[model samples]
Target: MFFTLPLSAATISAIGGSTWSNTPPALGPSWDGNPPGTAVDILSGQVDEYLLSGGVPGMFSFSAGTYNVTLLTEVAGYAGSNQLGWAPLSNLATFNPIFDGPDSPIMKQTIAPLEGWAFVINTGGGDVFSSSSIDRFLAMRSAGSTNGWSVGVEDLRSPTDYDFNDQIISVEAVPEPTTSLLMGTALIGLALLRKRYTKR
Candidate 1:
């Protein structure tokens, strides 16, 4: 089936009831909303691309703000001509906030880094965007890849809208693969040296 990993303590800060687009890593979009900042419509695969709420672009400033993070999905372009599930949308993965609360509705679950993150986008029950509908969670390797994980609608409401995009998610991680590679190389070298010494 599709690639998947177990859940971890990793979480991506997300907001409910927001539209997001794939934006490259760099200073975030315009921030003229209210409060500390306004909702951003784009995010990039590069974690460093995002900045503090009002950081300057093209500079080494960490902009900070609660901006929207967007991820691409495989369902963006399906062969079907229906707005149903697997249909192609200009945008890959965009969520309309399935779960919202009085204090905060943004979803922040324990999605580990370097794992696939898929949403079970089904419209049923009293609400469509409720986390309860998020039936399936896949093991996505990285946030750079498309966010499409296939799952069934076991306990869904009536009038099934096959729009799997209903469950929106992205892969995120802190870059550290280089270190892992180096450590692996050292271990291999040590093993070879030990073998040679034993032969002598």
Candidate 2:
């Protein structure tokens, strides 16, 4: 005879596409697309790299558009003290804080027309790590959307577990009808060009 017990949320390391500690905290509104426990590829053994939107690692930007950011969860030792912010490309000195600990669990913010930007996570005690530095975060696409992403953070450096569940957030770039039409036209043009070239 064999005995098996079902797993509780506390026994899992990830849930709803975010990582968790032994005793997971309450998460925010569900962001559809990437389901929980899906395997998202990040650089092996590198927690500070981001490869989203076909952009350079550690930095990302969408075409002119407004985007929504949602705070998903915070499971770090400093969950009540850490902060999340954004800065212009390569400009850590001007990082602006948008979300902080002890705020609403489902807090949301809107950013407009970003071209060049990097995300940073600020842990207390003067520890601030930027995406550009390749030292404290991971960013990946949100399942199938072209402009949606999920970012996870480790928050600490001393005993970096690389679980990336310490802090998690979702970014979604709102699509414009005009932009969609233009993209369709451009894609058609490229297809025509490719067809002509192939015929030759």
lDDT of 2 by residue, 116-192 (tens): 55567778655354434443555555333355666767677665544566667777765444545567778888998
lDDT tens digits by residue: candidate 1, 1-68: 12233222233322222212233222112222222111122111223122112221111101111222
Q: Residue 27 error for model 1, in Å?
A: 22
Off by over 4 Å in 1: 1-107, 110-118, 125-171, 174-183, 186-200
Off by over 4 Å in 2: 1-64, 125-130, 142-144, 177-200
Number of the top-ranking candidate, with lDDT as the measure: 2
Best by TM-score: 2
Give the distance in Å from residue 162's predicted Cα in candidate 2 to where it truly belongs: 1.8
Report the error of model 1 at residue 107, Å. 4.8
